[model samples]
Each structure stands twice: as structure tokens, then as C-alpha cells.
Target chain A: MRSHRDFARGFRESLAGGPAPQNATAQDPAEIERRFDVYRNNVAHGLTQALARHFPAIERLLGADCFRGLARAYIAEHPPRTPVLTEWGGAFPAYLADEPSLQSLSYLPDVARIEWARSRAYHAADSEPIAPERLQETATRAGTDLCLDLHPSVQVLQLLTPAGSIWASQQPGGPAPPRAKEWRPETLLIARRGISHVITSVVRSSTGRFVSALRAGDTVARARDRAGADFDLNAALLLLVENALIVGAGIETGDES
Target chain B: MTLPRKAGLGFKPEHFPAITETKPDLGFFEIHAENYMGAGGMPHAMLERLRADYALSVHGVGLSIGGPDPLDRDHLARLKLLCDRYDPESFSEHLAWASHGGVWMHDLLPLPYTAETLSLICDHVDEVQEHLGRRMLLENPATYVLFDDSDIPETEFLTEISQRTGCGLLLDVNNVFVSCVNHRQDPRAYLEAFPLNRVGEIHLAGHEEEELPSGPLLIDSHGREVAEPVWALYAEIVSKTGPLPSLIEWDNDVPDFATLMAEAKRASMILSGDHHALTS
Candidate 1:
């Protein structure tokens, strides 16, 4: 009798296109092979469908056949580590980035990153946005030492291509996003707003730097200094407030001055 | 909490507006527990609104209850939280394993029906029930292969698990048809031996047929309407067990809300003993 552990191990191997387990039972060898094929197909198809659902932009960019081929390779290499299908494709962006054949489509990986972040933001825990008065009070009392805690769903991604625009253009009814004429980098802020709505914004590089600093627990003064003299601090603050990205704000307890 | 002995449809996001606005006469709405595991989102908001008017069945697809590894504590905690939030009328999981060594296969793989496997499943079921603070139903899997080391029948294995763990059975009629046809066994015999008295729910789903050299392989794709033979088996089970909380599941290529509701209406008519509806 095979141990359950051995059986699971063998079964997983078989489903990944390996030979059928020696202990697999069927009326005949031919039947066993066919059964194995069915299992393999089911696993492959299920994972492919999941990937397609999560990364629609990538699928749209690569077309269905190419995407399916890529999905098969990705599934074989990185079978899900968790039973949560929603959380299955975390490593896909990195996988695509590392693929030699996909190097030409350089923006594909960043688009995947944006999609993954959107998924995370969509399911992230809900929280009450920080009241504008609280932020004002912190700004008045702490001046440059103010630090803001972003919402749990807030995510920032800095990409080397206009992937954010590309993703937005592919949305169901979104207008055609302007094409990038040069190798210009873009930064995006993704967060959930007003109950269940997910919102994403492409930000100026300076604002992205400021937000990144604030997210890293830097005080307002330090973040501003890092964002450089040209950074419009008020505009960045307004953007965060309007999007309900900041969840809490307080004075920096430690002296970083 | 128990659901009404009528037919229901698996809840999908695309159909939420129709379900809410029209308020279809569904006995209950079944949702995949994993889909609602997120802390807060549209899924929860929609479910909350629907919960006001419909009984809910929290069906889990990733508990991996039949795996060799120990039950996943984090996953169980999340499931418990969801159950507490929804207060669903019923909770259920599959009998086949989907994960091992911290890697989830994303497909329900068959387990060897041995003493060791049976004991493990019973323990896992017990853990889930105790943690969730409610009894759960275990659904039989649609398996494509059998293990050479198996010593017990599938029905007997499920019966023993239920008897030991005090869990209820979720007899998926489509699975019965798919598995029996794949294994070249009699579907009726399997149903006859199933402990129908212990059943608390029934699942109906569509399957696809794949032709191989050996024979026609039925895949439990759940992407189309329920086949004729599966419907017959379901009608047969209903005759013996009377009306249970049956669910019509269409996960892939899901048609419009009206189409799914139509399927549910069909099941409801059957459950209500309007045999004419099945023919019509």
C-alpha cells in the first residue's frame, strides 16, 4: 500500500505531465494513460483559465494562443503554492520578465505587475480614510515632521515603460491611452476608494518619490527634501487626499531632524 | 441553520444585479468560500445584500481535507471568519485533496481509499467542524483515475468518513455520473450504496465528454448544461431521498442570469415533484 504522502507526490508529478504512477489502477495500461492525460488536461486548463482571468491585459497583448502557451509554461514551472486561486499568479510578472522569448515585449511584465496590484487592492481590507481635518492638524502641529500612514490597500509601482497607460487603454470602455514615444518610466498608485471601488493613477516622478518616502515612514520634511525642490508638495498632498489613499496621519515620535 | 428543500443556483458576480433586482425564487445561493475570503470588497458587499433575502450555502473548494499533510491552519482561520461573517445555512468541501507540501495543485486529485487515508480525512473534517463551530458536508469527487492500493469502495469510504466525523454528505449527482462512466462502473449501483439518509445537499453540474482510444472520458468541466443521464440519476436520487437543497452550478462560460435561473427553476420543479418539468 502506498502512503498518502507518496500518492499525492506522485499524483502531482503526473498532473504536471510526468508518467503515470506505478500504483495507479485501471482496467489496462491504455486506460491508465488516458486517465492520466485527463487529469493533466484538467490541471493545465484550470490554471490557464485562472491566469487568463487575472491578467487580461497580458492576454490581450499576447493574444489567446500565445498567452495559453505562456500560461502552460508558467504553470509547469510555478504551480500555485496556495489553494487560493486569486493569489496564484504572484510570481508571473517575474517569470515573464525572465523569459528570453518575451524580452521583446518589455512592457508585458510591468502590465502584469499592475494587474496583480489591482487584484490585491480589490480584495484588500477596508478602512476608514483619514479625515482631512486630522491631516491638517498634523501638518499644523508637526510642520515638517508629519508622517502619514497609507491605507492598507495602497500600492505604488514604478515601471520602466508606459504599462499603466497600456493597462488603462485595455479596460472595457477606457479611451485609447497615449503611446510612449521614448523609454520614459512611469509610476502608479493603486488604492481602493469609497467602499469597494479600486482607483489607480499615474503620478509624476517627483510625486512618486515623495509618496514612496512617506510610505517608507519618512517625515513630511524628509520626504519633501528627497522629492527635490521642484516637487509640488501641495499637489501631491491633494492627490492623496482626493483619492482617499492616506488612512492615518500623526506626528513622528522619534527625532529624525 | 438548514436550507429549504428546494433548488438554488451558485452565486456569480455577473448575476448579482439580476438576483437582487428580480429576486429570483431561489431556495438558497451557494458561494465558493474562497471567493469571499477577502477581508472586504464588492464580493462581500454583494453577498451582504443578497444574504438579507436568501439562505446561503458556503461551499469551500480549497480546504484540501483529503490531503496527507495536516489541515492548513491559516486557511481554516480564514474560512471560520467567513462563516462567522455570513452565518451561512450550510458549509461544505470536497473529499479529494488539492494541496500537498504547501503547494496547491488547483485540481481535485483522487486519494487511495485505505485505512490511513480514511483516518486522515476524518480527522481533518473533525478539525474543520470544530473550528468553524458548525457541521460541514463533504462532497464526493469526480475522479478520473483509481489507485491500485485502494481497498474500499468510494461510497463506503464516504460513509465511514461521515459516520466517524459526524459530517453530512453532499452528493454531487454529476460527479457520480462522471466518475462511474470513467471507471466503467454502474452509476445506479454507486447511488444505491451511497448513504442517502446522511446526505444534506446535492450538487448538479455540467460535464464535457472527451474521446480517447480506450473510451469516452467525461470531464466534470461545469461549463455547460447538465447532461441527460446526470439528470436522470438526479431524478432517481430525488425519488429515494426526497427533495434536498440541490444547487445548479455553472462556473465556466456562464450564460446570462436568466439562463442560470432557468436551470434552477428546472431543478426546483423536480424537487417540488413536478416531474413534467424535467421533460419539458
Candidate 2:
């Protein structure tokens, strides 16, 4: 009997575009290659379906056949390391960003990134948002020491293209995409509105800086300062509150006023 | 723990709203264990809702029980957490392998039936049962190709695994028929050799047929409703087992909730029909 290690290596190789495993057999000699192709087709077909589900916007941006070609290539080059299909496509955006064929669509990678972030946010841990009054009280008491805790699902992405709008336009009933000349770099925010859906949008650059600071454990005052003068702290706070992103608030120092 | 001996449908997220609103009369809903491995989300929300109203069978598609490598510790821990959270009525995984050398193929691959392979499978099953503190059902695999080195019959290999590990069997009738047709064996003979008393559940699904030069090659696609021949084979099993928890599995190109319920209705009719035969 052939060792399993050798068999597995051969099998994986065959699936990834190599020769059929020599030990594999069919009832008829003519059927060996045809039979072996079943596994190959399945691995390619299944992962491609998973990828399409993960990045529907990308699929729409590139037609089905074109998307499938890229999907097959991606599957061969960077097969998933885990069984969790949701987690399998994290590396896709980066892969897209590096692909020479997609250089013309510079915004494609960021669009993929936002989609990935939305998926991650959709599956993030659940937590209760701190009450509006709690934020007011914490700001008054802690002042510079106030540090806000964001919800587990909160994610901010700073991209070089108008990827948020691109992703949004691809969504059902979403607003139309910005004109090519009107397109500009945008900061995106993704958070779960409830268990059923995620809130993904392009936020002001200042708001992105503020949320990024808070997510990095900055004090509320520091995060606010990072947003600069044009930043509307009220709007930023409202965004967090309305979307249920602020889970808790605390003082950076152990001092409780 | 065994699920109710009634027909059920494989849960799809797209059917969440319909299922919750209508609350279809089902014995249970089966979900792929890996799908819920995420920390929290609509998957959990839907599952929690369904779990409150119906029995759940946590079917795993990624444990790779027949692999050469050791069972993934982190994956096993996640499975333990999910099982604990849901407290499902039944837990099952495939006898075939999926992941190997840390790369998940995402498709259940075949295994050579040998003593060495049998022992390996038994060990993996034992580990899973011990880790989860529960008995699990191991399902048969649908293979497209055979291995030259396989000396043991697939049925006997499964029987030995059950006898040694005390794990129950999940008889997937579609797989039995697909493998039988692919290998030019008799599905009835295969069932005769199967340990029917140890079968805790039964699965029926669709397959894609390709006309090979020698004969028909059926791939277990699970893309549509159960075929007529598969229904006949399932009836045969139900007649013998008196109605295991039969599931209508439609994974790919999943139809609407009504379509799935219709299929489940067919399976339920068979189960109840067999029950009547046994009683009267």
C-alpha cells in the first residue's frame, strides 16, 4: 500500500495542476484521468463559489468568466489554510492589489478590502453599546484621561481610492458610484447595525483618524485632537452611538472622579 | 444523543427570514459545523432561533477524520465550543478527509480502505468523541475513483471503525448509490453489509451524472432535489432501520424554502410509510 503522506502529496499536487496520482484507479483505463478530474473540478469549483460569495462586488466588477479565471488562479496560488470559508478570502484584496492585470482598476483592491472588513464585522463578537449618558458622564469626569472602547465589530479602513463608494454602488439599492474624475481617496468604516446586517460607509477623513486612534487605545481627548479643527466631534460620536459601535468608556488612568 | 426520527432540511442562511417567519414543521435542521465556527453573527442568530424551535444536527464538514495528520487542536476546540453553545441533538462528520498538511481543500477527499487507514480513522473518531464528551456519527463518503492499494471493502472498514470506536454511523444513501454506480458495485449489497443497527441518521441528496466511456459516473453535487433512484434506495434503508433522522441536503444552487420543505415532506412520507408497515 502506498503511504498516506505520498498519496496526499500526489493528490494535492494533481488538484493544483499536476499529474494524476499514480495510485488512483478507475474500472476502465480510459476513465482514470476523467475520474481524477472530478476532485480537481470540485476543489476549484467549490472554492470559487466561496470566493464569489465573499466578494460579490469583485464578481460584479469583473464578469463571471473573468472572475472565475482569477478565482481559479487564486485558489491554486493561495489555497485556504483553514476550513472556515469565511476566513479564507482575507488575503484576496492584497492578492488583487499585487496583480498586474488589475492595475488599470486601481480601486479594485480597496473595494475588495472593504468587502472583507464587512464580512469580518458581520461575524465579530457581540457587545452592548454604552449608553449616551454614560459617554457624557465619562467625558465630564475623566477629561483627558477618558478612553472609549469600541464595539468588537468596529473596523476602519484608509484606502488610496474611492473603494467604499465602489463597493457601495455594487450593493443592491446602493447609491451610484462617483465619476472617475470625481473619485478620491476615502476612509471607510464598517460596523454591525444589528445581528441581521452591517453598516458599511465612507466616513470623513477626520472621523476615520478619530476612530482609528480610539481603536488603538488612545484617550478620548487624544482621539478628538487627532480629528483636527474641521472634525465634528458630535457627528463622530453620533456615528458611533447610532451604529452601536461604542461598547464601553473608561479613564486611561485608574483615577475615578 | 439522537435526533428525532423525522425528516429535516439542511439550513441555508438565505432561507433564514422565511424559516423564522413561517416556522416550518421540521424534525430538525442540520448545519455545517464550520459555518458556525465564526465568533458571532447572523449565523449564530439564525441558529439560536432555530435551535429554540427545532432539534439541530451539527454536521461537521472539515474534521478530516481519515487524514494522515493529527486532528487540528484549535479546530477541535472551536467545535467543542459550538457544540456546548448549541447543545445540538446530534453531531456528525464525514469519514473522508478535507484538510491535509495545513491546506484545506474544502472538498471531502477519498481514503484508501486498509487496516492502517481503519486504525487511523478509529483513533481520530475516538479523539473527537472524547474531546466533545459525546458519541458522533461518521458518514460514508462518495468516491469518484478507487485506490489500487485498498484491500478492505469500504463497508467493512466503516463497520470496523464503529465497532472499535463505538461511534454510530450516518448512512448517506446518495453516497452509497454514487459510489456503487462509480465503482460498478451493487448498492443493495453495500447496504446489506452496512451496520444498519448502528445507523443514527440517513442523508439523501442530488448527484451530477456524467456519461463515462465504461458507464455512468455520478458526482455527489448536492445541488438539487434528491433523485428518484436515490429515493428508492433511501426507502430501502428506511424499511430496514424503521426511520432514522433523514435529511434532505441541498447545498449548491439552493432552492427556495418551500422547495426544500417539499423534499423533506417526501422523506417524511417514506419514514411514516415504513412505520406503518412495521406497526400493522
Candidate 3:
């Protein structure tokens, strides 16, 4: 039987470029490292490629060498448990937050956070965005509590790190990603706009109203009071509707009204 | 207008756009099925474009076919979804390995070819076939170590698995070189023992060798061009195996798209070398 200790030790060694298990035969110790190097190289490069696939923006932000260095460190800190690598690196954003080397680029964690959302949105459930008929029925329910069900692929990321703009400027056809200080910490609304994932900077004026209304299924009027600002109800509804992220909605007749 | 069957290249993300842009005439393309399992995204969209233009193969690296634990249901379901989506020309995975006992290793781990392991692998292969609703070709594994108590040779074990499961075999020539050198066995013996009739695909990869004080061990790194010895073995296998659907696999340190196609072209010439002379 393969002991847990032996497996763990071998795994660590494999990650660290050390000797693999001498389980096969009493061969030279150097032989273990020599042979193990292939697996080692594979593990590192495979994960690196997977990471790059997951976060193409990050790969572009930090050139290949820097990305490789970041990837190597991330691998050392969080080795992958599943062979299904597309979903690996779930903890990388958190890992980025604590990485001292990234402290200089203080908003790097938020960038990673946004990148991870892109990964999740890319693979999230495939559901029809809110159909027009459903939205009409919900709005027409007489004397009932209105509710809005967000699209499964929708994510509302609240970061104080100015990442939404960073994500945008980095888009393939968009202008080159703006430099630091060109933008400030802000909120973002990301949704799978068809097959493409789109990130938009949540205008400072509307961020508060959108988050509360979207999450709590609040009445449009009630949501306005909560934010206490001139929220553009027309533009707000258009944002959700035009993007086709409004998947499900309902109205409760027997509420505490 | 179409890709040949002699030898193909494994397509990675970096080469996706270029391959489409260049429209090179080569053999089919192979991709890991699991990578394209998402509902609909870049991999599938691009793959659709490629599929429209080329013969395709969907090779899997994570089925965990010989482990002590139950096979992963979710992974299998997703793989099935991919198979249904792509309806690939050929599909294949590794032999002599099991990654998951409970948690998956992700990397292919070794199994001793004992009766217990053989039964276990057959069970897993059966499950894979039942779930995918189609037979998958099994590739031989590259190894770093060998167990003393292994009762059967890896090829014989693979042959038995193929015979029992009715699955095809994917003969990876580089793995033959790596395992033979690491275990100090004759590569030719392995080729001789392999059930050539069952072979449905061929794989060529580069391996790195490091000499030890005891003996040198060749690692199936797949990070370089096909080694000379491995190329020689590929020639032998192709001549015997008779123009199988071969792939040149360079998964790491992937060079520009042209480099991969160049290597695939080399394998194509070798496979169809009745008229072409060996490179001097």
C-alpha cells in the first residue's frame, strides 16, 4: 500500500525538484532527481499553461518571465489537487493578496480577483438569460412584491482596486491597458454577454443602487430610497435587459404589503 | 482542403489562431477532451472552426482508469459531453496508470500489473466505455520507476486490457523509449510484445535523458523535439503498424505553430517513406 507519508513526501519532492521515491530499487539518489525532473518540468509547465489560459489578462500584464515567476511561486504555495486543471487556481487571488512581491502592485489582487471571475463565468452554468415574456409577467403582477433573478453567469464584483477599468482597457480591441493612477478603485458588473464575458465599470453614481437592488430583489422605488440618489431607472433596467442577464423573475402577491 | 492521416500535431492554445490563419495542410489535430467540456466557449468555438477544416481526435489525460477507488463520475460525465459534442475521429488515453484513489493525482501515476490491478483497470475501462458510450484507445505510459512485484510486462498488460475491453490502442513511441531506458529493457522487445493489431493511433514526443552513476534514465519530458532514438522507433512502429493516425506531442515549452507542423511533417514522411529516403 502507498503510505500517505510517502505519497506526500514524493509529491513535495516532485514539486521542489528533489529526489522521487526510491521505491523502485536501491538506485543512486541522483538517478531519482534526474528521472523525476521530467515529471517536475511537466507539472510546472502544465500548471503555468493552465494559469495562463485561466487569466490571459494577467499573462499580458506581466510578461512571460514575470508570469512564469508568479506561476512558479503560486504552484509552490498551492499545488493542484485535481487533474482537471481548467478549474485549478481557485485560491490564487487570495495567494496574490498575501504575496509580498505583489505588494508594490497593490491592486494586483483585485486584478486576479477579476480574472478568476472571468474563469468562473467562462464555465458557469449555461442558462437562458431572462426572456422578455418572463420579465413582462413579473412587472405586471398586480399588487405583488417584485423580484429579479440574476443570470447564472452574472457576477457583481465589488473591489476598491480599480480593476474593472484595467480589465476593460486590456480587452483585445480596446486601447492598451491604461497606466496606474489613470483610474481609481471602483466597482464592476461582469456578465456573460453571449459567448463573450464583458466587464463594465459601474459608474460611481449607480454602483450603490445596482448592488442593493440586484441582490435583495428590492422594489425599484425602495431601492432608490436605499441609495438616496438620482438613480437612472431607465438606464439601469436597460443595462440588465440589453445584456440579457435577467434570467428569472417573479412577484409575490401575499407579502407584508 | 483536408488534413492527412499519416501524422498530426497536438494543438495548444498559443497555436489556435495561427493554425486557423495559416491553414496548413497536415494530419488531424488532437486535444484533451476535458479541456473543451465547458458549455460553449473559446475552446469549443475555435474547435468547431478546426473541426470543420480538419480531422480531429480528442485524447483524455484524466480518466484515472486503474485506481483503487471508484472512477470520477463528474469528470466522466463532462468527458461524455465533450465526446458527444465533438464526435472526434479517434479518442485515446494512457495505460499503466491510475491517478485517483480518492483525490486525483492529475498526473498519471503508476500501477503494478498484478491481477488485482488488471481487474481494477478493466472495471474502470468498462465504466468509461459505458459512460462515453464509445470505445477509447489506450496509450502506454512513460515511467520513472518500476515495481519489483509486477507480474506482467506493461505491453502485455495493455494488450490484455485492449482485448478484454474492445478498446483500441494508442502506441506512444516516445513512451516506449522512456520506459525501456528507465527500466533497462530493450525498446524493440516492447514493440514486439505490443498488440499491433489493436493499435489505433501513434504518438511521438521528445524525451530528456540524464545519466546517473548507476544508469541513465530517459524522462518522457515532451518539452523538446523527438529524440533520434525515439524517431528511429517511430519509423519501426509505423512500418509495422502501417500508417496509423500519429501525433507529435509537444505540450510544454511549446514552440511556434510552424515548429510543431515541421515535426509532424517529419513523421508524415517517415510513415509514407516508401518513396522518400531517410534523412542523411
TM-score of chain A of each: 0.92, 0.95, 0.83
Chain B, TM-score, each prediction?
0.98, 0.97, 0.94
Candidate 2: deviation at residue B229, Å?
1.3
- Predicted complex 1: CAPRI docking category: medium
Write candidate 3's Cα lDDT for B1-280 as tens digits.
1124577889897797898888987769999876776666566767888888889888888776765656778878888788787778877887744353344435676656777778778888888988888888888898876655477879889989998989888888998888888877899998999899988888899987777777877777778999878888877877776787889999878899888887888887888864252452
Q: Fill in the DockQ of model 1.
A: 0.70
Q: Pick the candidate with the highest lDDT.
A: 2
Tens digit of per-residue lDDT, candidate 2, span A1-257 = 57887778788888888877888888896788889899999999999999998899999999999999999989878999998898999899999989999999999999898888988998998787788888889878987898889988888998889988888889899889999797799998988976757988789989999999999998878889988867998899888888888889888876444
For residues B48-89, what per-residue lDDT tens digits would candidate 1 score against the true structure? 998999999999989899899998999999998988988999
Best of the candidates, TM-score: 2
Root-mean-square deviation per candidate = 2.0, 2.4, 4.5
Question: How close is every model to the real structure, measured as TM-score?
Answer: 0.95, 0.97, 0.81
Docking class of 3: acceptable
Candidate 1, residue B206: the lDDT equals: 98
Between candidates 1 and 3, the one scoring higher on lDDT is 1
